[model samples]
Target: MNTQPSALANSAGPVSGDSAAAKSRVLQIDRSCRLPLMFLIACSLVWLVAGGFLSLISSIKLHAPGFLSQSSWLTYGRVYPAAMNALWYGFAFQGAMAVALWLMCRLGRAELMGGKGILLGAFFWNVAVKLGVLGILAGASTGHSMLEMPGYVSPLLFVSYCLMGVWALVTFHFRQERQLYVSQWYLVGALFCFPWIFTAAQLLLVFHPVRGTLQAVVSGWYGHALITLWAVPIGLAVLFYFIPKLFGRQLHSRHLAAFGFWTLAAFGGWGGMHAGAPVPRWISSVSIAGGMMMILPLIAVALNWHLTARGAKGPENNQVFRFVQFGAIAFFAASLLDIGGSFRVIGEVTDLTVFTTGVKALYLYGFFGMTIAGAIYYLAPKITGCDWPSDQLAKLHYLGSVVGILVLVLGLVAGGILQGVRINNPEIPFVEAIRSTIPFLGLSTLGGLLLLAANLAFLVNVIRLLALCCCTNCFASNRSPAGSGPAAAGANL
Candidate 1:
């Protein structure tokens, strides 16, 4: 059963019935979001492309070693962190913000307020990110893992965030709907979670540097907490909202969802501390325990969603479901890998190898990226007042993302395992261990190429759709009858 009504989009049908009134509200919400969401999503896609390009450059350097040796700005040291931060701040955070705001307005029955301010905040955030990435290329990075952006710009990022964050809370505060949904729970949590994680990370790592092993401890905590707090919650928010609604089913269980949410809140940040970390032994032990304990929430969520979407098949025709399904599955796999890898036995083997790359790819690209893609696919038509202009490109992006991430994760994991094995063996020379990983690195490079191509297609599709809307709006404005103004023309967006 297709849950989405497809005959016409944003068509002003007879406003005679309850359904019409309901749709009018939906369109109103979409319209309120049109410009801001479109701008944020466009920025995200551009950053996504930049992140992919830098990542590919870094991956190639793993094997080729001299792909861009002539350029100081493109050195692996700079490019790798630059790539990660681009995805982190530039693509993922902005995209998540866009999705979070849209979800709030739609699910909570809230009108978006402070639209222009939100847009300004987004613009400044991008400026800060641009300067930060450039600073990294210029050797001004703070040298912290997640807080690599220079200290000078951190205030701007935080201030810019507050501009948006305060408004997000305000929107939710004034929502018409009295009952809060599960998706809103995750979204609200993420809205608060990011600031806590970022501020603490920046204060300790950047403004006033922590000393010795504690800095590493703090860095490790920040990196892991980011995935758990910011990324995972937002990704789950999207999944929980979309899966049942798109599949035409009610959620499986409220109790289970509450279970998942609370358990994740309690345990999520505690994981990602490794056994060998120089922190107190008990800290590592607690972290390891917390990580294993996270499986409880993971199982809870998997059950809630799986049971809800049980009868529905993966629909090729529905790009939203396809991407959402891919993301949900990846979330499970990635979470499991993250939990399982925390065991001392596994951690000892995979530490400092390409296996970490596989895990990051699985979590970031496979889980969160795909979820955002699905949300964009679902929201673009409503917000733009038009469906995608090209199906072929959408399908191409889907195939490429699914195949590319899978290949990259598997190749890196297998390669990393072998690489780790060689590193752990005293008889094996470090040089030999490095050489053993080259073949797998080559495979990951190929995967990166495919991923890059897919994103290019996605970018083109977005641009083409937006162009069509713009042209339609412009054309309509020129030929409109008397009293039919911008709002009337906007209906054709």
Candidate 2:
């Protein structure tokens, strides 16, 4: 494999004159977005913790319905939507934004411009999410999956997102590097596509309100597009950026990447509607065809990444690489599952069941969450100028997350299949089908608890690191000026 020095590697290893200069430049760029990145990550952790608690309540309520039945606010309907909103908007989007912004700055070789605007944008984004989640709990939910946030909160989110998007575009415009990397393509695409999908969904589903079966079609399209175009693209950008860097090589094939990118762009938007929806036959068929066609791009991407990582396997021991690799495998696995589930025969059994939920968990937590975790592990130290406080914590987090997600997904799939079989049979009682899923639901709850513990460990580590950084700054500031002394010293780390 042909290789070149990665942006991150410019600051690693020996510190000769040229190397020192290169490292300094990289640190300077990193420092520019430090505040914004830290803010995003911190907010994401807060949301992760909150989401974990909500999820635990939700999971428990699945089998033990009386657990919180007395509290109207904690009812299954409200808690479920609250948990989903917290996880999706609070943790997922924030973490993804942090990763995307940081990667864009690093790849562009440009210090992030409009730092204040970006920070302000992040603040408003969190505010909007908070209001949206609260509204859902207050029974003001729009009742659309992934678009559950109430009507009023939509504009706040859209405006905040536009601010951040503007910063991204401006940063890219003023980049030092003229040539765009494959990761850049993915990042830019995600940045641009989100608002369009978000706005259209808001208008069709929430504001104007689509009529009858067309509502299902729009909902299906919005859900699928959001995952494929927004979440998956962000995750893929990280994979493309880090795989070669970790392996000390360039990507296996740029041509393959381009092909993958365009194919995904062309088909992913239309592919998600076939998931056992109540739409017309033509609509479902188009979705299935699009999904089947997406397999080619997924294969292209998987092969490129696999071949890149085939040789230098030493870094696979590192937590960042390990998480990324796990996520990459999960991505391919999830893709295959989606393709199979899109078929009419399989969709008939899996649609509107726990099986679909299992696939979503695999994609969101297994693939997107894992990849973002890897990116955070890799970038946090660089941005904060402090090494992670403990490798033990990192390892614990990785084990818990990976195992928890797998168990949760498997349990859901098993439960869904059992329920689907019973439900499909005319002689079977609905209550009996529900009863058959209790054990698996319990297992899923256990998995959620494990993940909660893992995230708490991560939160502790981050807090410790931040405290250390603050102490170091305070100590340095006592001896010299406030900004220059500690800031320069931290940046050099």
Candidate 3:
């Protein structure tokens, strides 16, 4: 007895008559959500490619400034900042929205509300992000650090985010299921936290409501929290879904899961201060303590996931499971590094170096990036009503992402250590330290290329699947008699 409608209820494309009426209801809830998913994939791919080009250019400028001295737009300062904005806003954040919508639908047992509304939100969000990123490249930035995308950009961002947040909230409220699961807790908290933090940061930083180190404090707080508060929820929601679903088991301990969620929400806020500690020791200490305290919550989460999967069958043979499991492992590694890196002793040497970047990448790329990749692999076929266009392409996506991220992380860590060693050595020439990083930078560039290829492969697979879903003739052919016309076409293709 199938609880869901078999013929077309779960199907994301096409229906007729009695089914069509119900489908329209689902579609109303679905249309707005799916575009965000497609837009995210498109935007993330563009960012990945653009960021790769920028990284290569920035690397060249690092070793040799004369390489692009004539082009102000391609200069190291502009290229580096523009690349950061692209990766953060254009890729990572946008990707989070896609993941969030998917998770909300699956976990909450809800469909999208108004597709038109979602499209409008997507349009405004993309426009705002494009302008903000271009503003960074054009040096219209307000001289702010990570939040450098011009004053006007903040208001636009705020409005777009608010719309997205509301959509999530409404979707959650209308969810058909009872007793919301662990993923819903994370999704709801994430939806609420982002707006509060974003609004406060925008007001204090852009509106000039605060001054001096207070501004730095607010910025650092908001900056780091954006990852922990905004991105972490979606990532955790992915973990909640895939870790158990892949292994065919419920979570090992619901009590432990709740504890982890509440503890993380409580402790994640204070750890933002760690980034500002170089200027203010007290602030740094607070951040360091908060970061260290985060271990309890993280350990609980790690224990629950690992224990749950320990006795069950592993998903190693499946590509989606492989990507997600590896990413889950990295989450543990990243949290440990987060604590160590936030400490004053370690921060003294590694804060400005590539090691910090490596840790950050591990968190973003290794943890969050891999989780979403797995979800995309699992969800795309369901939504598109087709198998992946190419199994080889799926394998390529996994291998490329894994190998590329490892290469990139290793290079950054190695280069950073060398940088730290040289900086601590009073006798070492500053020029010598810079010279030593050239090889590592080259390796990082190659790694970026690998990751870019992986992303492109993923996009192609998605597009091909979407195309298949739209082909009603293709679906009709599949329903034909076994020995009749195009049986092999339905099977093999």
- lDDT (CA) per prediction: 0.84, 0.82, 0.72
Clashing pairs in 2: none
Per-residue lDDT for 1-493 in model 2, tens only?
1134443332121111256666676777676667778888989988988998898899899999899899788999999889988998899988998888888778877777776777888899999999999999989988888889999999999998888788788878877666678888999999999999989988999889879878778878888988889888999999898788777665778889999999999988985566446777788889989878879889899988877667566474788888988888889988888888888888888777888888888888889989999999988888777789988899899999988888888888888888788889878888988898999999888888888888888888888877776677546564433223224423332
Give a tens-digit lDDT track for model 1, residues 1-493.
Answer: 1243321110111111257666677677666777777888999999999999999999999899878899899899999999999998999988898888888877756556677778889999999999999999998988888789999889999999888777778778877665667888899998898889889988888778788888888888889889998899999999988887776666778789999999999988896568887788988898889889889999999999888778776555789989998999999999988887888899898877889889989989999999999999988888778889999999999999999999899889999999989999999999999898898998998888999999999999999988987777546665533113223323432
How do the predictions measure up, each by TM-score?
0.93, 0.93, 0.87
TM-score, cand. 3: 0.87
The reply for model 3, stretches above 4 Å from the true place, is: 1-36, 273-278, 472-493
lDDT (Cα) of model 1? 0.84
**Backbone clash tally (model 1):** 1
Give the clashing pairs for model 3. Answer: 29-112, 32-115
Q: Over all chains combined, what TM-score does candidate 2 have?
A: 0.93
Query: What stretches of model 2 exceed 4 Å from their correct place?
Result: 1-18, 478-493
- Per-residue error (Å), model 2, residue 415: 1.5
Which residue pairs of candidate 1 clash? Answer: 384-493
lDDT of 2 at 226: 83
